[model samples]
Target: MSSNRVTPTEAWQATASRAADCALFFDFDGVLSPITDDPEASQPVPEVLEALDALSRLVRRVAIVSARPVDFLRARFGTLSEVDLFGLYGLERSHGKGETVTEPAALPWVPVVEEVASEARTALGDKAYVEFKRLSVALHWRKTPEHAAEIESWAHAEAERRGLKVQLGRKVIELKPPVDRDKGFVISEAVLSVGCAWYFGDDVSDIKAFDALRARTAVEPGFLGVCVAVASSDETGQEVSDAADFTIESPVAVGTFLADAVKILQANAAS
Candidate 1:
């Protein structure tokens, strides 16, 4: 095991020598874009997009696993034809060519999420706000810190009533159907089907991917996996950093990391 923390530049240089054995994955919202007051309007940092485009040529597979709807992420970075997009924590998948493949069972969960969001809004009142993501719904209390406890209670109770699962993220609580899917599960499946994997993320939800990477390595010797946590000053960011194998300062750092990886891969291919 490597104990020294490598910067994005160093990490890429190391991987360039073993390009064929690596796969890169990222969490979209916080990893690629700065968290915004309005989740619906979040966009990736300019450098992040450019880096992803460059990295696409280096590794065998580069993907994004996120809680956002597939279409939403596709709209943001779909212009690049070399990256794969996985949304809803792997419940949905979109290819680089703009084609999407989704789990059939996940489709029906949409209306259930809508109903839950409506009920949550009425129950929580103005103390909390609701974000209706296409596949999931989030109740945010960042602006109303006092309502965190109340929001959590309501989310748990409401999710139970609807037979759905509630995920705690940052200062928000999300409701999604209890699917046999998660970021970790997705990463494992991707690795088995594609060789080795790397994941970058910035939230507690991403811990599932980190755990998955550890588990896979334990069972299979010589498996190449990299778990990265993008850092911020928030509690959620701290949690993710603790769970990750390495930490990067911000989204720009992530972009620089990806771009460097691409360069290494290209140089190796030419050599």
Candidate 2:
């Protein structure tokens, strides 16, 4: 809602008008689906699928960069086509044909993550909750605010012991493999391979992608890229919005924005 920031609707319109040579990136959890207590339970808004289908036809490339595992995301959106999917915060990339590219060094981290989850469950006891992601383990302190400090300490200690990295967002802390790759790195690589790019995200983790876009624009004129945040009354959402070029009210708004972008691109193409 800053003076210089655009609304999701307006940003989508601008993106659609210049769809050619554009690469679109999306964050799955909060941007495509409403965040839930159980991350695995998150489901994309119905319209998002339709809009992605349309947008794929308009843009040069569309990719999803998420912290979820590639296999999980593929299973979730198995029917969609022409949209590239990157999971584990871009540590893994997969296409529709089931071909997957992953950092070989990070492959061993899966079992490490599982071990951490077990450790968290044992360490936290009944005070905190653990969500086991294939590539990472998230410790949720939403239901145990009194144990936030303890949870953070445990997460840090476990990550250090495993020689991994920790990412803090909202009321959750995640342990990811120690790699120099992230959504930003993925976006930058994608742009180099493709061209202009745009990104939509809804959490602090997505800030990396936003920063990447800003950095790219500074070096290249008319980059035709923007970062959008899906705003919510939560710390993670606020952090993401602060770094974004535009903010949408909710997941529903995000779907509407995507749908509008597809319409604009289609209309422009027809004209």
Candidate 3:
């Protein structure tokens, strides 16, 4: 926290030393796979898949937290005994090999989310696409950047009207049910208990997860929490980079970092 940013190698080395109590968390888009305009086309790099397969052997926990639906994530990564999937920003979760669980509190808001999704589709018309999920509705303007501001304003108005929370991400605006959960809550309450936690993320919403780790470290100063921002040197991701303890330029670098983590943990085990 004192220094600006540590090199990826330093993070990997430190993680290796704390392997017994280490947990790795990742954000899917732009962290595991390259950000694509066609979200359906996004796929994890082979190196990332290999690294995760290896980490399953080394770590106590590996959690992928994302705004994607749990079903979509399950289809992409399959079920792993050591991996937990926190989807819809933790509104929905799937434990290793278990069925996806929706928070009971979030269920009542399903109709509300559907209504908003309908409004988004009508308002944005052809300029944007509405992504309907269990507890949230997202209006994505990735393919229509010129309509970004208009779509965002409408999404915000709808969220405000419905007493929903607005989640801002890259070229997307989401209306989430007014739940007390987020990436931060999920990490603190459900995932990260006894570990030197490492989280890699690439969007604005990921700051809350980083904040959760920082709060824990503040109470127990010996706690090692590494926040890795996967972002380009571009201005768009500066906020994410600034909030993180370390930075990796792209998803490719993220794959390399994870692979390095696997090797380091494997080496430590052999020793």
Candidate 4:
């Protein structure tokens, strides 16, 4: 927890007090799903999903903004139609089971992204796991931590050559189209009309979202922006914790925290 630490109940009460005008945003990995070596195998804790199901109805809106593609997020959250999905760091969006909409600017880069992924797979080989998203490519060195520096250097060089954007994460580097879109851009736009908003995230990339909230709070009178970091042993977790308003232990704690938030919101409504 940072100096801004507030009890879970206090945090919930503040947001629940303005539930009608409040919006909630979350990052899928680490915050909702446990981090795993195999990215494809990660699954969100059912308890968290259960809580989100309730939270969506209580709040003005609920959304998951992630680096994964909207198709991937939709597969995981298809039933939660009330929850909006923003994937590929805001390049994609799906509103409440609606069509997955891609930013027009990014559509032209699909071929380039595919080419990059192919080149990365051949160049990196068994040294890294190359993930191919339609609009981006991510190289993961988690299993072979010793190759982190090598992977990072190669990713940066690739980005420079291809005019792509490089996103660094926990033992991973992603190359995407050079569009000026990111987690911060997503949050800043989403909260424009919101009176109170809370964003939960767990990686270094998530820091942008926290920064977005702080920036908004600074300029918007009577607006509340809560940043909750999910703690882990990884250095990114520490960085996120430092930037966050408070810290929750892990994805398990996130489930409990959301459940508790639901209870507080209900009680406040009844009162």
Candidate 5:
């Protein structure tokens, strides 16, 4: 583990000290699951799921915040009822087996998003993989790196014409409704009553959540927020690590870290 602030052991100890008042937030891809060219094939490591399950019992709340849809997340995390799933960057959220609650402002844009997805597929013509989520669409150029710029340009133009919002990711550009929802907003609201929180992520978009933690720690006395970055190679990875309070190597490392966390939290509770 690498950190500029408190050491990893200290961070774990702080979280353990307030286990019941601390919530943990995680980004699915590159944090729990390894990033894959085929998004559907991405699945969290089995041990990581186990670690999260153990951590869930010790924390106030544990949530997986991702750019993917709720259904996808649920399919993998269905067995872990204590873990909340926030999908589409907080456009939709489901607590355990509960019904998914979508942001009210984004409802009307479903049809518009559908139209954009159709247009994107037709225009891109397999040069890019177009993923059509109900409230958003993502154009992925991971398989065809040559069309990266073109796909990004098309996505931006579509977002502008449709009055949607554009979110950039690794080899992907997503267009969602113009609603004011994101990981930062989600974390800020969830941690309102909590004493401490930690957010783990690997992508640049996760920076917003890190900033939210900083914002909370700045104003809220005695509140502790730790930002953990899952290390990567690209520019986005570098930016994320720079904003993080600490860095871990990969999803596998995340699994080990969470397991270690569970041990400390359990020990602290027993003491």
Candidate 6:
């Protein structure tokens, strides 16, 4: 772990004291579940969601912020009253798992994004299908890792041509509207009501959330803001780890951390 990050013991110590007032934020893929080549195939670890259900009963708030769409998120998470799923970063939000609110500012970009997805599918064929997202398009090359560079380059050029933004992730490249919204915005908005905010994530987009936590902690010196990186075997995890205040080994470790957190929170509540 880097000097900036606390060990698990230290993280527990720091969080335990403030658990009652803390808000927990997590990224979906790679954090709650392992990444899948088919985004549609990704599902939360059963233990993970069950742990979240347990923790949510004790915590002030629990949120899952991710690049996945709200519909997919709602389907997988399924009416978990304790969790808020913010999809496509902050462009859409599902509160109490009831209804998702899509930002109106993002509405105008839908047609353009759809057009980009269509073009990408026609050009890349089955290799990069499922390019149509109302707010973004993703070209997954997880199965074809050898073509990563090729796909990335092409995606970048296409994004530039179409005035869109591209995000790099594990075995995937996403082209989204060039909106100001991101995981950072979601965290920044979330931290205002909570005393201590902890965010766990595992990708380039999560870096924005880490930076937000770091920034909010600076101004609100009393805020216990923690950034946890749920890493994979790849280098992408290293980048996320470098920016994190703590790092967990893998999604399984995230479950362990969450379980421990639940115990600590419950213990503190009892005491």
Q: What is the TM-score of each candidate against the true structure?
A: 0.92, 0.91, 0.94, 0.97, 0.97, 0.93
Instruction: Give the backbone clash total of model 3.
Output: 0
Residue 151 local lDDT, model 4: 90
Q: For model 3, how does the per-residue alpha-carbon lDDT over 65-166 read when each residue is reduced to its tens digit?
A: 999988888877884666889999888889766889998999999999988888777878988988888689888888899999899888888888999999
Better of 5 and 6 by TM-score: 5
Name the lDDT of candidate 4.
0.90
Model 1 C-alpha RMSD vs. true structure (Å) is 1.9
Q: What C-alpha lDDT do the candidate models reach, one value each?
A: 0.81, 0.80, 0.82, 0.90, 0.90, 0.81
Task: By lDDT, rank the candidates, best first.
Answer: 5, 4, 3, 6, 1, 2
**What TM value does model 4 have?**
0.97
lDDT per residue, candidate 4, 178-241, as tens digits?
8999999999999998999999998989989999988888898688888988874465456788
> 30 in model 4: Cα distance from truth in Å?
0.5
Count of clashing pairs, candidate 2: 0
Instruction: Pick the winner on lDDT between candidates 3 and 5.
Output: 5
The list of candidate 3 runs beyond 4 A from truth reads 1-6, 190-192, 232-236
Clash number for each model: 0, 0, 0, 0, 0, 0
Candidate 2 has an lDDT of 0.80
Error of 5 at 81 (Å): 0.8
Q: List the residue pairs that clash in candidate 4.
A: none
For residues 20-107, what per-residue lDDT tens digits would candidate 1 score against the true structure? 7678889987789887777888898888888788777667777989888888898898788988888887878988867788888878
- In candidate 5, list every pair of residues with a backbone clash: none
RMSD of each: 1.9, 2.2, 1.8, 1.4, 1.5, 2.0
Across residues 1-271, which tens digit of lDDT does each residue of candidate 6 receive? 2335567667656777777788899999889988766778888887788789888888788888999888888888775877888999888998875877989888898998899888877877656545566999889887777777777888999999988988877778888888888899999988988888888888888999988888888888898887888875575556778888767877877887788777877777788
